[model samples]
Target chain A: DQQVKQNSPSLSVQEGRISILNCDYTNSMFDYFLWYKKYPAEGPTFLISISSIKDKNEDGRFTVFLNKSAKHLSLHIVPSQPGDSAVYFCAARAEGDSSYKLIFGSGTRLLVRP
Target chain B: NAGVTQTPKFRILKIGQSMTLQCTQDMNHNYMYWYRQDPGMGLKLIYYSVGAGITDKGEVPNGYNVSRSTTEDFPLRLELAAPSQTSVYFCASGAVSEQYFGPGTRLTVT
Candidate 1:
C-alpha cells in the first residue's frame, strides 16, 4: 500500500513563473511533512517542511502548505529558477515513532525552462 | 563533517552472489537507515538502526541483512543476489527531524 502518493509524474514551468507540486497521504497519523529536492546522481537535499499544527510554512522562495482535513500538502516556488529543476520528493513522518521513519511519495520531476 | 558516506558507488553482481554495502556517518547520529530506489519509484526502507547493536526491519527487508556493530557503521548484506535486487541504495542518518543522505550506491544484479 502506498501511504503517500504524488499523482503527477512530471511538471514544467517557466523560470519566472510559479511551480507547484502536490502530494497526498492516506495515513492520518502523519504529523510532519517535508520536501526534498534531488539532482541527477546526487543525494536529495532538504527544501521545506510543515507540521500538522500549521497550515503553511515558508522558506525564501519555497512555501509548503498543509491541509490536514484533505490529507494533502503542496510545495510552491515563486519565480522558479533554472536551478529549481529537479526531482521533488514529499515525505511524511508518523506520530509516536521514535525512529522517525518517513513514508515518501513517488516524486515529481520538475522542469524549469530558462 | 562527511555527514554520511557509502562505499562502492557502483557494483555489478551475478545471480546467487553475495555482497555487502557499507555505510558510515561522522555526525555521531544515533539513528541510521538504509533505503532502495527502483526506476520510476520512490525510496523504500530496507532496514534501520536506532543505535549501535540495535536494528529493525522496515517495509521491505526480505533477501537482505544488516548489522550495526558501531555507531558510525551500518552495513547491508545481500545473501543471494537476484535481478530484482537491482536498484540504487541510499544511507541516511539524523538526530530528530531531517536526515542527511549519502550519494548512493548503484547496484546491478545480472
Candidate 2:
C-alpha cells in the first residue's frame, strides 16, 4: 500500500511563475514531512521540511504548506527557474517510531520552461 | 569530502548470483540507510543502521542483508538474487533528518 501519493506524474510551468506540486498521505500517524529534489542520475537532495506542529515552512524561493485535517501538503516555488526542473519527492515519518524510516512518494517531475 | 561513496555504479547478475554493494561515508554520522528505487516507484528502505555493529530491517529486506562493522562503512549483500531485486540502490548517512545520499548503484538480475 502506498501511504504517500503524488497524483501528478509530471508538471510544467513557465519561468518566473509559481509552480505548485501536490502530495497526499493516508496515514495520520505521520508527523514530519520533507521534500527532496532529484536531478537525473543524481541522488535526492533535501529541500525543506516541516513538523506536524507547524502548517507552513519557507526557505528562500521554496515554501511548503501542510493541512493536517486534509492530509494534504503542497510545495510551491516562486518565480520558478529552469534550474529548478527536477523530480520532487515527498516523504513522511511517523512519530514515536523507533526505526526512523521515511515513506516516500512516487515523485512528480517538474519542468520549468524558459 | 566524499560525503557518501558507492562502488560499482552499475552491475548485472544472473539468477542465483550473489554480490555486495559497498557504501562508505566520511561524515562520521551514526545513522546510515540503504534504499532501493524501482521503475516508476518511490524509494523503499531495505535496511538501516543507527551505529556500528547494529542493523535492522526496513520495509523490503527479504533478499538482502547488511553489516555495519565500522562507523564509515555500511555494505548491503544480496543472496540468490532474483529478477525482482533489480533496481537502483542508494546509500545515505545522517543523524535522522537531512540525509546525504550517494550517487546510486544500478543493478540488473536476469
Candidate 3:
C-alpha cells in the first residue's frame, strides 16, 4: 500500500506566480515529513522538512504547511521561477524507527512557464 | 567527498541471470539502504544496513540480497532475475534524518 500519495501527476504555473504542491499520508505514525526536488536524470535533492509538532516551516521563498488532523501537507513557493520547474517528491519518516527510512510518493512534476 | 556512488549506470540481463549492483559511500555514514523505483511508481525499499555485519529486510526484499561488510559498502544481489525485476535502483546513505542518493542504476531483464 502507498502510505504517501501525491495525487497530482503534474502541475503548471506562470512565472512570478504561486506554486502549490500537495501530499497526503495514511500512516499517522509518521512524525517527520520531507520534500525533494529532482531534475531529469539526476538524483533528488533535499528541499525542506517539518516535524509533526510543527504546523509550518519556511525558508526563503519556500514554505511547508502541515495539517496533522487532515493527514495532509503542502509545499508553497511564492513568485515561482523557471528554475523551480522539476519533479517534487513528498516523503515521511515513521516514528520509533531508528533506520531513518523514508516512504516517498510517486512525485509531482511542476512546470513553470516563463 | 564522493558522497554515494553506484556502478554500471545501465545494464540488461536475460531471465535467470544473476548480477550484483555495487554501492559505496565516502561519507562514512553508518546507515545505508537499497531501493528500487518502478516506472511511474515511488521508491520501494529492499534492504537496509545500520552498520557492518548487520542487515535487515525492508518492504520488498524478495529475490534480492544484501551484505554490509564495511561501513562504506552495501551491495545488492539479484538472483534468478525475472522480467518483473526490471526497474531503476538507487543507493542512499544517511548520517541522521537526511539521505543522499546516487545517480541510480537502470536495469532491464528480458
lDDT of each: 0.92, 0.94, 0.92
True contacts kept of each: 0.47, 0.71, 0.49
Could you tell me how far off, in angstroms, the CA of residue B89 lies in candidate 1 after the best superposition?
0.2
With a 3 Å backbone cut-off (N, CA, C), the pairs that clash in candidate 1 are none
Clashing pairs in 2: none
lDDT of 2 at B80: 98
Instruction: Show where candidate 2 strays beyond 4 Å.
Output: none
Candidate with maximal TM-score = 2
Candidate 2 chain B minimal-lDDT segment of 10 residues: B95-104
Better of 1 and 2 by lDDT: 2
- Report the poorest 10 consecutive residues by lDDT, candidate 3 chain B: B94-103
lDDT (tens digit, per residue) of candidate 1 on B1-110: 77899998999999999999999999989999999999988888899999999999988899999999999999999999999999999999884368889999999999
After aligning candidate 3 to the native by TM-score, how far in Å is the CA of B50 from where it should be?
A: 0.8
Name the regions of candidate 3 deviating beyond 4 angstroms: none
TM-score, every prediction? 0.97, 0.98, 0.97
Task: Please identify which of the two predictions, 1 or 2, would achieve the higher DockQ against the true structure.
Answer: 2
Cα lDDT of model 3 by residue, B1-110, tens digit: 78999998999999999999999999989999998989888888899988999999888999999999999999999999999999999999884368888889999999
